[model samples]
Target: MTGWNADSIPDQHGRIAVVTGANSGLGLVTAAELARHGAHVVLAVRNTAAGAEAARRIGGDVEVRELDLARLDSVHAFATGLVSDHPVVDLLVNNAGVVLLGPRRTSADGFELQFATNMLGHFALTGLLLGALAAAPEARVVSLSSITHKSAHLDFDDLMSERGYRAPSAYGRSKLATTVFGVELDRRLRAARSPVISVLAHPGLTRTNLTPRAWEHRGRLGRVVARLGLLATQPVEQGTLPQLRAATAPGVRGGQFFGPAGLFETRGRVTEARLSREAADPAVGERLWAAAEELTGVSYL
Candidate 1:
């Protein structure tokens, strides 16, 4: 799809959307745009203060809700609250994630930081919200992956980075798991004959606070490197194209992946991007899905 832009997003009237990490970056832009198109957008973020600011900026039917993905308790509370208020969710964009950070950190649940926050949290969120998603006539779940996923491989024995951890490697592996889960969820939904759909999208290289924040704890050199890389990346607005397309584009199929079309998919019009053979491996996806169930204690069809 050449020349694809936000203008292509159809009217989202009467639809309800839940966007995680919508306080900033790609998630924020996506939520704002969806709200502009008349969708009742909920900004599910960890920091209620930041989320409120984000909602104020968007200025629509957007509401801020506390959702700390790293903590299973917070995840459950958020999901339960959302279900009670809105029985049906037309769109669930699992877009919140952490970037490559220095050293190994543990989530509130004691799992590796990247894998827990980026992959596991989203996994549980989707599963817990399955009922709400299925209640909608035609629901769509869009999971955000990354180009780095191409270089990642899942190591079940060390899913939590117990053996060793490299910042970039951990980030890639987490993203790979997210991509696999997205695809696997679609297959399960199809097998169950559900109207819900799952699709994946990548932001490519975009100028967001993720890299800067992740590298902040690494000292001066890390910040310098991150800033240099950001200079060559596209704006958050352009970076959000693929996911928005995956969320609303017509004729979009479950399991399809979308990304940029130019310069190794770093920046350009939205188009179908490539997925690594490893990411397409059904065994890996299935095993990861099972492991996620074990870790998050959340499961779905």
Candidate 2:
């Protein structure tokens, strides 16, 4: 738990990894590090051109696959093709996300954009890829959550923020949902005696493209916060270490969450971070699981 960094990752020769939104930010870093450690990483991204560019930058055994997490059809197609092409998957990093979306927006599937992209899509993808993950020597499903989730609560009746919306609130709820899904997944996998483990991680206050992109709709306010954000963020290289540790560290267990070790968990090396009381509640997990299954129409242990 102390002094951990990407260099601590074990040799991953021959392992197969799939990372969502791997073209930039934490996702790109996660993919690059895994590949650097000898894993054949698949950069699952929305833009094929950008993904290709990212692959070239990564300079390793990497492939680009298009996947738009906001659309269920795309998620289904991506997972189907991936599972068929790669029968055994060692790692699935659910790292793609959008934040501080200024106005209400919906996905092709009609769900709130933030909820759909950050949580529901990953839920369905993980369930669809369960078989490939289970077949591995040891597999991990790493769900990227956030510090914002600690301040949010899920209201099942308003899961999609259909009645009303606020940028930060909606984003927080979406992250909370992702956190719940990760923990519940561990319990379900354990009960089923599955070999695949579920892990959680968050890059605290990292300088990423998500924040500036998210605030784009707000115009002037966007520019202001984006600048303030730049002042507070840790470097992308350091921001990525938490998830990297979660993915490749030895002795990491199901449901374990990795985050920064600094004050307020905003910046530092990788370490164990506490889950919010709400996120750890079994009842919340059960309800969120049912709602997710109902919403996404994907079911698995």
Residue-wise C-alpha lDDT for candidate 2, range 259-297, written one tens digit per residue: 998989988888888899999999999999999999999
Candidate 1 is scored at a TM of 0.97
- TM-score of model 2 vs. true structure: 0.97
Candidate 2 ranges beyond 4 A from true positions: 216-221
Candidate 1 global Cα RMSD: 1.2
How high is each candidate's TM-score?
0.97, 0.97
